[model samples]
Target: MSATAAERQFDELASLYEDVAPWPFRRDIEVPSVLHSLGDLTRSDVLDFGCGAGLSSRLLAGRGARRVVGHDASEGMLSAARQREAKEQRGIEYVSRLTPELEQRFDLVLAVCVLPYASTRSELRQMCASMARVLRPGGRLLALPLHPDHAPDPDYYAPYGLRLVSDTPHAEGGALRVELRAAGVEADVTAWYWSRNSIEEALRDAGFGPVFWADPWPPGLARVEDAPPALHAYLRRPHAAMLDCRRARVSG
Candidate 1:
């Protein structure tokens, strides 16, 4: 997708995004659990990349982050976040710019459902690098993405989305209306399913020491009927199945 188109796509989604996404929004999980597992963030500066409507950021604030900043590429989303912030009387700093005006060095960075919208690997890398650049040595990152191991392929490009064999609303024959990316969006725009080695390699390449991995199938969203056995067993086997990793201390 062209830069302009990419911007417009999110702008449109921001218009009625909240209404269509209420249930999952209410069920959001990875954010808090990941934070808690990392221990106290009360005195740490935090950054929420792809902050979306700032729902997760608000959660961080309630958890008592020293200072929180959210950055996204969509102005409409930022506006929505601003509205929410004003309504709740919270003090999150939301910016539409991809890179926030931050040099204070964050102790933690939280990203959920980011990377999917990235049109290319480079964009994803840039975002990762941006986080590494801003984080203090030893800081941790908790990232969540929609393209769970069994993601419903977006745009039918990558062929990784959940394939239903039963039935559901948006889906009639196969598994269910769980997923089927429209032609409008490119497969590349969706977060490519990064395998364990790839993520480790990418993180190390970006200067982040590998900590661990988490929820291959986060219950944050509805379950896909045809999710592989490995996916189901992992999510249900133990809530702590996901990875919890950290970077080494700064050497400089």
Candidate 2:
């Protein structure tokens, strides 16, 4: 399978990504919210878009999803995911992408940290539309796109395994590049900034709404005590945002 630029970047970073995500974004926020919101997945079909090494897919499958499909653009990441599925025997189906031929639709779709990889406005629009297409009407989408309000500052996120390596202005808007580092592991990733207006516009055009921005301290936080103390302050300020949206139902 051909790799997207973002996919190749992730492929090189996949091993380290399993160990060190950008901290608060993954551990303190997105993951907790996703698992909490999916309270009763007993018979739900779940899609983990950009499933990476399949961490979210396995989590959803074990939590009683009737079917869990992990779709990613990187073959390396999918290979690792399939290896784990082989060992664990979880009924997860990993694919490079959701094709037109696949008639199945999901009840819930989780796209944590997937949007910022889009380098262009049209790419982002296509992604949002593609996600909408795979969801059954009334299906829910949880998207964690990077916050346009918070472009990286030097030393701002150093405590959380991320360092602002560079920033440059683009015709599209602001862009920030950062390096994820921890204990002898390092990987460079770029996150494109999209205004809230553009993001909401894309979702609305894709037939999803009324989109709701999730609260930083979701009710799920009360159950997780392992989050580091430093996260509390950052939570109050928006570094990234969770967009909770539902596909609109068509009228008969």
Model 2 agreement with the true structure over 37-137: per-residue lDDT tens digits: 77889989988988999988988988999999999998888989999889999999999978875533888898878888877788789889888989999
Q: Any runs in candidate 2 off by more than 4 Å, and if so which?
A: 21-25, 165-173, 218-228
- Taken over the whole model, the C-alpha lDDT of each candidate is 0.56, 0.76
Best by TM-score: 2
Ten contiguous residues minimizing lDDT sum, candidate 2: 164-173
Per model, how many backbone clashes are there? Answer: 17, 0
Winner by lDDT? 2
- lDDT score for candidate 1 against the true structure: 0.56
